[model samples]
Target: FTNPDSTLLTKAGHHKLCHYIALTDAFPLPIDKEEVSWKCLVKGAHRNEEMINKLEALEANSTLKSRVIDYVWGAGSQLRGELIYKARVAVPSAYSLPGSVTEEELRKALNWLIQRMQLTHPDINAKVCWPVLYSFAQLTSLKACTCSEDKPWQHPIFPHLIKTQWWGRKGEAKKLGNKEDSNPFINTPITLMALVATAVRPFLVGLNIF
Candidate 1:
């Protein structure tokens, strides 16, 4: 690509050492045709592009994905996909709503993030547009909506809920996620032994209004 003027084959040599290991006796091919094509490319030089054409020319013999595919999707002890950094998000304080995001702000925030990250290379500056512009395009359209977010701490918002969400139980609120969380003698005095309804008890302890 650095070359000011070059032919298609000019950059071909660099791509020569690429290898495509889509098929082995033990491991079956994954679902992506592009991956298989690129995989074929790395296996050998001239053999690479042949796989690309082959991928386009023929229909894939579809098969169930293997365990290897599953593991990569989310292997042992590891979480999967984007928003691996899921955490409670607060709306920028400047906005009128104290704890929640409006529909438009939410849309714009998501749109900007998706575009900045370039989640899809082919489609840059992807827009999170509405079905009908006239629906919510008024000057007063940005009216803030409040969230009765009783459980703000566990909000696996957006993609987190849609694609990835998790649940956790707690015995004592004061106790951190450590050995003390479990041992009654050490933690009971600090914050009495919590009831079995762990989800509700902790939520009621320190909420704002009452």
Candidate 2:
């Protein structure tokens, strides 16, 4: 664990410290290395404003964009590709993910979709649009998605999920047969807003996607 206010590592350890910061900043922790195979590699991963800027500017076409966005969201939002994709299957939300979708697959899809959209609407803001679409896809499907016994929950896996009523429209809570509200339907718009608000703003500005 890093001391919040102090430097995690010395100047000589910049490269090493960068990785841990990257993990902490990009994903929710209490992460178990054994569960995922790439744990060790991430230990010394580089992270910085320059690196972040580079990543944000890499490309936002459907394919690469989707993968990058998925990685970013998956890390920070604490979602897994299989889980999110499965949710996509249950509803026609912000974006679509067929049963076969993977982080790699979605990356390709987003790259193609965003490129086509950009050609016709050059004024399109890829940064905001990319995540917005992803969120839309996730939220629409969230209303009807569920996890299996082996599935991991970003939050806690509970028996019941309390879906918030959209637009204060008096929506009903669907029962997943548990006492806890584990899979609640997140407010899509708010989720989207939060994502856009906290994204690396300078990077978006550089891409002229703000």
Candidate 3:
């Protein structure tokens, strides 16, 4: 058993343990050309090539058809007419491993994990909604599609709403005498307004008053 917190395990020990687990559990090896080349030089390139080709054939035969989206929603909203956006999301660091793999393979694996979460978790699905709105708004703003008209959420009506919300929050932050709380939005009106507009659009669409 590997103990992640154990002081006895040096960095190299932890890495070797991870490598053993990856190999034994048949996880995708981390892309490590140097390590692969070294192994090939020691064990003979033909033998290594034969093993890799067999693994590739097996992977091709068993590849799943499902796909996953690469992004997540950053939930932003208004509270009591005050603009608020969620804290920045933190992505966990990728596990360190050594093996040969392409960028596409890594992307596919990550997306697969996301798809699994979306299938099994309702909370994650709800959190994803705002980011989807953000992405849509960005694409529409950039005129990435053939649709020529502006989205209802992108109209001028919402910026006023956002500005009002922001000033209200600024007042509240001042009353609380907290420098940290007040400073976050002090010079961030434009950025905060954009996030607020993105957050508000979905609800507006649902209300069907457009």
Q: How would you encode candidate 2's per-residue C-alpha lDDT over 99-170 as one tens digit per residue?
A: 454554444444543333221121222221122255437533222212232332221111111122111234
- Give candidate 3's TM-score: 0.21
Which structure among the candidates has the greatest TM-score? 3
lDDT string, candidate 3, 119-173, tens digits: 1111121111111255437432221111113342343334344445433555432
What is candidate 3's CA lDDT for residue 97?
11
Prediction 3 global C-alpha lDDT: 0.30
Candidate 2 segments whose C-alpha is farther than 4 A from its true place: 1-77, 80-83, 87-112, 117-187, 190-210
Model 3, residue 79: what's the lDDT? 36
Better of 2 and 3 by TM-score: 3
State the displacement of the C-alpha of residue 57, model 2, in Å, after optimal TM-score superposition. Answer: 42
Q: Model 1, 1-210: lDDT tens per residue? A: 232221222223222211111011112234553354333333323545753443333334222122212323221112211112232121122112223534654555444433332221221222233333566674433322223234322222322222222212421222334465463323323111111112222222222122
lDDT of each: 0.27, 0.29, 0.30
